[model samples]
Target: MTESIEKIVAELPSLKNVTGAWAVTDERLARGDAVFLADLGIALARTYGSSRQVWQYRSVFDHLLRLLATTPGRDNAVQALRLVGSAEVAGRKLDRYVTSLLASGHEVADLTAVFTGQASEELRACLVHELVLRGVVVEETPGIARWVTSPHWSHHPLGRLPVRLSDVESRADFPNYGAHGSSHSMPYGPLESRAPMVIADARVPSVEETTTQAAAGAMAKAVANWAEESNGRIEARLFVFAEPLDAGSVPEALLTLGLECLRGAGKKTELSVTACAPAQVWRVLFAAASSGGAYNSGSYGAYGRLAAWQSMAALAGCPEGAAVSEVEARVRDGTWHVFDADTEWFEQVAWDIGVAALAPGRRDLAVLAATDTD
Candidate 1:
């Protein structure tokens, strides 16, 4: 197997004679040779940075993606995908392939299930994210959604902040800390008149009672690691309010809390707050789950999705053993009030600073402030 695959890889670079080389590879691939597929996958990874130009490798990618769409070739193709990380490398071609596979009547669950037990958790998460990016709505099954949305995978891929697919399409307008950062706040209409208001005479929960320590810890970690650059720092804190306030007052409330959290740490500054619809918040969290915090980059896989679910579960205080779909349903139902703000403390690149969410009924507000020079 090794010698035969080596011959194939060696002959592949002969661009003029590549047709004959692929003819041999095609015959072997058609027979469903998993070992050959796996070896070829590894070889493809190595070949990516070789002296040959990228376009010359198109045949290799085409074969892998073609096999990826077929049932017999699916698992081996996934293993190859794991080795090559083609979701990042192949980009649109991968998207078109996945899209075509789905259009051809392949069940999303069946395709996603191919990744189970075949790849590392992180790779699985990234693959799933790639599938979602192609507009595939993955089923919320234990093997699929649960793994991707778990918080355990969140810390491994640093600076992976997921955003909605729609947002990804309009990424030009999406906020980031980069040169293209948007100056405008996230636009949403006035809060619904029927939206729940803060109870009069309500008492703020103690730091200990506002939210579970685990939730707070996860939020802090997420905010701190939201970006890849090392020059910036992020702080996340949860605040509970007990005073009488309406949706109209959330910005001021958030501003007050923001001021308190930033006190003594740096120069005092005021934050410009904006009200975000619950639907928008849901999309952000959903994007996180779908893309594993990759922003517009192709999916990183399950960790981002898992972390988003875990964060919501912790915030809404969902019962143990709750289904991810149930949690998602609740989030989409406006159980949380969301807001984002900006301040001078950080060079507001992206939506890094002044992002916060208030839990339904409990009034627990989670605030994240981030500053990134890069």
Candidate 2:
């Protein structure tokens, strides 16, 4: 509904610190790098796909994005993170502060002092925030600026945001998708453990391209994974958003989305044979087949395994859930795992998971996919 910190962070680049410099010579410069890297990390964290490559915690990136996009300076956001993590303010204060800075060259030294209660860190961080917020600081080594904002689309990831738990679980969290995850789960919290994840580097496709690909890659992969993991014990579900004609034509694109994300990560996955169920009967007949003994009526694959299913979204028989036919989703472990994402659908969950899209969307559909022939 509202713009996000990730939207802005997606514009920044993930910092490797080529100098490998442990520290910067000057404090403000260091703070500038901190803010810049923070933005880049946020975008990287929010990217979607199956990369599973680990890096610095994405929350740090998102927290910094919240700081830069919402707070006026580094120190202020530091306090903001505490307040943010501690349930003080929902971080809107950061947004308001940044809005003022954007309209009128504002600085955060004052608020930084208010937050950290220390004079020096406040000054250093605030200065860094000021420069970056105004588009001055950047990662020119790669010929890139530190931060900017853009949309999450159906693919084509140039990118990239953040949010809370209690607020998220409430109806106020994401009205459209509604509240879907844990308010306070476990070691799985952003604190103790990160979910299996990846960063996206995809670009946007036209409606035709999106549906074709969404059904193929995004939709298919989600299904393939579930079907492979849950095996036939569970029936995968998808929330199709397009009209009938479009759904019928998306098998190829679905394959594209799944294969690209898999191969992009150098996994060398293969597209599983796809089976379609007519929308009317909503009938799907599963065939247990994998050239290398990957699937059968008896067993599922190992964890994080994927399989591609590109045909059910357009099933005209459409179940009761199909009333909201605009999107496709998977029913997993009693939870509706939706991943048919565009810019809008993915905003809350992916960011909450510390992920950004290689592309973007609103409709979240769980794409089940599979690993290939051994």
Best by lDDT: 1
Per-candidate TM-scores read 0.48, 0.19
lDDT of 2 by residue, 1-374 (tens): 22234543343235453112112112222355333443343344445212434333333333343333343454434443333222222333333233223212224333333233332322223333333323332233122222122132212211110111111111111001101111211111012222322323333233222334433333333224324544222122233333332222233334344332233322232222223222211111111111111232111110101120122322212232232222223221111111222212112121111111111132333333222221
Alpha-carbon lDDT of model 2: 0.26
In order, what lDDT does every prediction score? Answer: 0.46, 0.26
Each candidate's number of clashing pairs is 20, 79
Candidate with top TM-score is 1
TM-score for candidate 2, residues paired by index = 0.19
